[model samples]
Each structure stands twice: as C-alpha cells, then as structure tokens.
Target: MNIQQILKISADKLRQKNIPSTALDAEVLLLEALSKCADEIPPAPFLKGGVLANDAPRNDNKRLDKNWLYINNNYELNKKEEELFNNFINQRLKHKPVAYILNRKEFYGYDFYVDENVLIPRPETELIVEEVLKILNNDRREQACLFPTIIDIGTGSGCIIISILNELAKNKKDKIIHNAYANDISSEAISTAKINAKKYNLNKKIKFIRNDFEKFLNKKSIYNSNEIIITANLPYVKNDAYKTLSEDIRKYEPKIALTAGRDGLVCIESLVKSVLKIKKKYKQKIYIFIEADPDQMSRIMAISREKLANVNLEIIKDLSGKKRIIKLLYCHPELVEGWKAR
Candidate 1:
C-alpha cells in the first residue's frame, strides 16, 4: 500500500483502540519506518524551488519529516518499510508510548535517547532548564567569578542537565565557570542518560552518578563551588494518581520515575531536607529549580519555608498556566535581603 493509505489504516486502528494523538502517532511511526528503509530507497525528492514538500524543517537526518509523507502520499512503501510500520502500529495498539517505541524524546530542542528504563522527558520539564539558564545568565551579569556546580537529582534521561549545558555551550560570551553532575539511583536509567549525554558530545561535560540523591548530597567533597544550582524533575505523582494515569504512561514508562508516595511529595520532601543540610554546611549561594504537579506547589513552598530560613521561593507557570516549577533561592543569611529584592 501507499503512504497515504497505510497511514489512514494505522490511524484508524489506533483510534479504535482509544489512543490519544492517533494521527500524530501514525505519522511518526511511519516516518521512523521510512527512515529504516532509507538504505534501500533514496531520499525523497525536494519540492519546487528547493523548498521542502511538507514545509516542515527536517530535524533528524536519519528520519524523514512528517510533511514528507504528505508530499509523497502516493509513494509506495517497500516490503521492509511495510513490515516495520506494521510492527510499530501493533506496539502502539498495545498502549506503548511513541517515544518508547522510537527510543528517543526531544527536550529543549535536543533529542535524547530514551527507553522503558527512563521516564520520557516531558515538555513542561523544559521550564527547569530555562530557570537554570536564567540563573547562569544572572551570574554572568553580576560578574560572579565563582564557578557554579549544577546537580541534577534523579536525572532519569539526563535531559535537564544536558540541555542546560548545551545551551550554555552555545553562547560564546558565557564566561561563567561551572560543573555539572547527573545523579540517579537506577543503573539502567544512568546508562540511558549516558547514551544521551554522549550523543550530544556531553559525556565529559557531565558526571553521571548512579547513587541515591540524598546520599550523594551528603558527600560534601563533591560540591566544591560556593554557587550551587540544583535542578530536579523527580517523581511527584501520588500513588493513587499513578493508577489513574493513561495506559500509555503507566504501562510503558518507568513507574519508579513517576509515582512518589501517598502525598506525591516523598522525593521532593527528601530533596528539600538535603538542601537544608547543605545550606547549613556551606555558606554559599544556592538556587534550586524543581518540577512538580501544580497541586503540590503550595505544600512544597511551605516545606521549604519550614526547613530553611531566609530562603526565597518563586513559582513559575508553564504554557498552560499551571504552576510547574518551584524556584528556591537560599544563600548566606547576610545576602538573603539583597537576593530577595531581585
């Protein structure tokens, strides 16, 4: 069958199975299949005047853009492409996520390798990267010569830390010295994160630690910088809420990366406590950006207030206007008043 016909059939099958984003899933899977068949078939012809047929820019050289399918609606898929597309559709029908099937997810405009071992990077999580960049930029403006240490707690796919480093590397004027570390408890998750880090040529830029966050934080020797920035997208889904999540998420994504505990704040709470200890131990300027469910923002603020004195907290809303990131600024008591005014 041709591209158009096969896409319709696959989308219909997914729709029948009550899958969300049926059409998108179908197109993405077909594009991936087409990529695998690239060795057999030559690249699709460009449209008139050197413009892309679908008008969408190609991000991956290995994968064809979805618009290519529209441009080549009548193009016939060979046996290998047809077989691969069908296999992917079957996985989708079983409630698997498209990211898991593709083994890749895009975060902060960079694609990272992913799998069942790691949580698929979410769009909202990009807010953490944005916040971190803002902090780094602020340091540059103030001419803070001190090197900052960035720690990404529970770095499932190392998306947060890697993206931050990639952005920093892009700005030639960025003179801030910094260190980056990705810490996760799961060895498999660390392995997946390493693959992505190496993909972006960031293997040496980030240190991957397969250890619990609390334990890693206790090792004072690792944190040698006075300006420390922490970014975490830890599991904040309550146990009960986890059960109600869509089959695509619950069945395919790693559960340990999703659900926290009864209150959904187990991981965040522990992180806060550890930060307080670090704060007490070092008279340093610390900034933390944490992504959590909107409903849990107030509780997180309250926890921060109770544990750390003179810490300033801010809530950053996502595109949907949901409180998605909690920014915590804690520093030496003498500097609190000055930082709070900003």
Candidate 2:
C-alpha cells in the first residue's frame, strides 16, 4: 500500500491502543523506516497529470520530513520499508516510547543517542541548561581567576552537560576556562552518555565518571576549581506517582532514572547535604541548578534553607509558569549578604 494508506492504518491501530500522539508517532516511525531504505528505494512513480508540479520543496537528505510524505502520499513502500515500519508500529502498540525505538532524543536542539538504559530527555529539563548558560554568561569576575567547573550529577545520557559545552564552544568569544565532569551510577548509562558526547566531538571536553554522585562528590580533585556549577536532574517521581504515569514512560524508560523514594526528594536531599559540606569546607562560589516536579519546589526550598544556612535560593518557572527549577547560589560568608541583595 501507499504512504497515506499505511499511515492511516497504523495511526488507527495506535489510536485504538490509546497512544497519546498516534499520528505523530506513526509519521516519525515511517520517516525513520524510509530513511533506512532511501538508498535501495526507486524513484517516485510518474503522476498522471503532473500532480507534483506545485508540491513543497523536498529535502534531499536521508531523513525526510513530514511534508515530504505529504507530497508523496501515493508513493508505495518497498518490502524492507514495510517490514521495518510494521515492526515499529508493533513496538508502539506495546506502549514503547518513540524515542527509545529510534534510539535517539533531541535536547537543547542537539540530538543525543539514547536507549532503555537511560531516561529520555524531557523538555522541562532544558531549563537547567538555560539557567547554567545564564550564570556562565553573566559572570563579571576576571577570567584569569575564574576556573569554572560544571559537574552534572546522575548524567544519564549526558544531555545536560554536553549541551552546555556545545553552546559554550559555539560562542568562542566567551573566554572563560571550563572544566566539566559527569557521573552516573550505571555503567550502561555512562557508556551511552559517552556515545552522545563523541557524536558532538565533546569526548575530551567533558569527563565521564562511572560512579554515584554522592561518591563522586567526595573526590578532592573537583574542589580545586574556584567557581563551581552543579546541574542535577535526578529522579523525582514519587513511588505512587510512578504507577500513574503513562504506560509508554513507566514501561520503556529506566526505573533507576525515575521514581525516587516515597516523597520523591531522596536524591535532591542527599545532593543538598553534600553541597552543604562543600560550602563549609571551601570558600569558593558555587551555583546549583536542579530540575524537579513543580509540586516539590517549596519543600526543596525549605530543605535547602535547613541544610545550608544563608543559602540564596531562587525558583525558576518553565514556560507554563510552573516552578520546575531550583537555582541555589552559595558564596563565601562575606559575599552571601551581597549576593542576596541582588
């Protein structure tokens, strides 16, 4: 059958299964299948009345867009494409996420390799990257004295830290010296993250450590940098809430990357306690950006205040105006009051 006919059949099947984005999933899966068969596929069949005369400009690249499919709705899929597309549809019918099926996800406008081993990057998590960039760009201190180190705890697919490094590299005029480290407890996650880093030529720009964030923080080497920034997007889904999540997410994504303790604050609280120790021992300036469920922001703020006295905490809301990011600024005792005034 042709593109339109097959898409309708697949979409109808997905809709029956109650998949949220039925049409989109069908199109994307078909697009990927077509890309893989692009080399062996023949040209489009001749139209009877020059039907393609006013069609949108088609992209010659292997990954064709939805518009290309629209213009070629009558184009039939070859045997290989049909088999692959059917397999993808079957996976979706089982409630698997499209990202895992594609083995890729886009975050901060850059694509990262992903799989069942890592959590698929979410759009809300991009706020962490944006907040980090703002801190790096707004620093007025002398470049010579500022050795900025960015540590991403529970780095999963390394999307957060890699995107930051990619942005900094793209804007070369910012001459700040950057040291970056990413640590995760899962060896498979670290391996997956490394693949993404190398994809963007960032293997050397960021260090990947195969350890839990708590243990990784104990190393004395990270404290050498005077200016430290930490970005944590740890698991914050409560145990009960995890059960209520969509089947696609709960079934496909890694459980280790989701569903924290009962309160969903286990990971965040531990990280805060560690930061407190770092603050007490080192007089350097430290900034932390954490992404969490909007409902838990107030509790996080209270935890920060109780753990780290005089902490400058700010809550940044996502586009929907929900408090999704917690920005913590820690400075020397002398600078705390001044920092708070701003």
Candidate 3:
C-alpha cells in the first residue's frame, strides 16, 4: 500500500481506539516504519488507493502529497518495522507520554533525559527560564562581571536550571554560576539531574543537592540567600486533580512528584515561609520565579503577598495567556518602608 493508504488506515484505527493525537500519531508511526524498513518511497503522484474513494474523504484528506513523506528502498516493512510498531503501540496503549517512550524531552532548545523518576519537563516551564535569563542578562546584575549565580529549587531532571546555564555557556558567561545550585527532595531526581548536568559538561557549573529545599532554607546557614536568582518548578498538582488523572499516569508516574497535598500548596507554602524568613535575616532582596498550575494562581499570589509583604509580586502568563508562573522580589521590610517613605 502507498503512504496515503497507510496513514488513512492507521489514523482510522487510532481514532477507533480513542487515541488523542490520531493523525499526528499515524504520521509518526508510519514515518518511523518506513525509515526502519529501508522501504523505497518515491515522490510520485498521490498514489490512488481504496482508502481515497469512500472511507477516507478526498477533500480534507490531509493533502499529504509525495513531498510530505520520505520513502526509499527502506519503504517495505521488515522485522525491525514490526518491532518498532509494536513498541510504539504498546507504550501508547498504556498512555505513556511520547517523551518518556523516547527517553528525552525538549526544553529551551535542548533535550534532557526524563523518566518516571522525575516530572516531565513542560514547554511552559521555559517561560521561567526565559524570564530569569532576561533579568540576569541585561539588568544591573549584568554589570557585576560576576557569572550569574542561579539556584533552582526542586530542580527535577535539572532541565530549567541547566538550560539557562547551557545557553550562557555559549557566551563565555557561565563562569558566573560558579556557585549555581539545584535541590530536590527526591534522591532519584537529584541523580537524574546530575546525569543531565554531566552529559552537558555543566557538572562544574551546577551543584546538585539532594535535600528538601524548604528544610535547607530553614537551616541556620543562610549565606546561600545571596544568590541573585532563585527559580523553582515545584509540584503543584492538587490531590483532587490526582483523581482525574488517567489510570496509566496514576499507576506509573511517581506519586511524590505529582501530588502536592489537598490544596496543592504544601511545597509552595513551605517555600514561601522559608524565603520570607531568609529575607528577614539576610536583608537582601533576591529575585525569585517559579512555575505552578494556572488554576492555583490565586492561592499562590495570596501566599506570596501575605508572607512577603515587603516584596513586589506578579503572576506571569504563559504563551496561551494563562497564569502559569509566579515572579517575586524578596525585599526587606526596610525596603518597603523606604519606598513608602519616599
């Protein structure tokens, strides 16, 4: 059968089986099948097929012409094709995410290894990195000539924090993070983050700390508060939300990484209190940005303003205009007083 025929057959099968990305899924599966089998696919006229007549409508048939797909001597299915197709179907049937199946997730123009141990890096989280880099790059912070010291709280898989370091490395500016740090409550997560760091040669620039970030902050050693940028991608999915997750997600993914308690404010609340206490003792205002569930924006903002009364806080929206991030400046009470007195 030709490319168009296979796509129609596969997409219909996927739709019948309730796959979400039916068309896209079909394309991926078929393209991989062709590549694995060394099938010869030519840029011939849209090969007419039984699917084109009735079962598949002609008009919106995706217009997938010869130019769209690549087929060569590899077009014919082989033993490898069967294995690849079986693996993809089995994983998808289990609702495992594509990134996990591929063992890589793209973020900030780089790919990081991700598995069930850590939360999958989301495209939305890149906004936090973008904002952090912007603040560190062109602001007064840029004048110090010191490499930007960034600490990522709950740095699962080290994606967001490492991406910033990687981007800066290209400019010979990564030396600033000579003091960079990343902490996560899970040892597995810390290990995974370290792997990514080592793979990118960012091991020297990033310090992986396997500890509860909240507890670390509550410690007596508050000198670390001197970091200019503190970013976190904390667990914010609510307990009720957990009930709504697919069976595969609930059964296979890490529970600790997904659930954040009843109101989904456990880690966030602890973080707020710790940062507040640190700001009071250190008296140094530091910039902080964190990613959270859009639904939790009100709760997050309330915690921010209440705990950090002296600071200015704003909710950052994602590309879709949802409240996807929280940005805060942890200012000392005196800073607020000075501003008000002015």
Instruction: Name the best candidate (by lDDT).
Output: 2
Cα lDDT tens digits, model 3, 1-342, are: 545555666677766767688777666655544444433323323333422222222223243333335332123344565567657756766677666766677899988999889888889999998898776566455464434447799888899888998877776666555467888989998999998999999887677788889776665543543345789888888999999987557866788877899988898888888888777777655778878888888888887888777678888999899999899987667765865897
- lDDT winner between 1 and 2, please give it: 2
Error of 3 at 248 (Å): 4.9
lDDT of 1 by residue, 1-342 (tens): 988899899999999999999999999999998887766764455654576544443334557776667767877788998999999999999999999998888899999899999999999999999888876766454454667888899999999988888898897433464678899999999999999989988898788889999999998876787688889999999999999999999888899899999999999999999998998888778889999999999999999999988899999999999999999998787566766786
Candidate 3, 150: how far from true, in Å?
Answer: 1.6
| Per-residue lDDT of candidate 2, residues 213-244 (tens digit) | 98898888888878899999999999999999
Candidate 1 clashes between residue pairs 3 or more apart in a chain or in different chains: none
Give the whole-model CA lDDT for all candidates, comma-separated. Answer: 0.87, 0.88, 0.72
Candidate 3 Cα deviation (angstroms), residue 78: 2.2
Which pairs in model 2 have colliding backbones?
A: none
Ranking under lDDT, best-scoring first?
2, 1, 3
Between candidates 1 and 2, which one is better according to TM-score?
A: 2
TM-score per prediction, in order, is 0.91, 0.93, 0.81
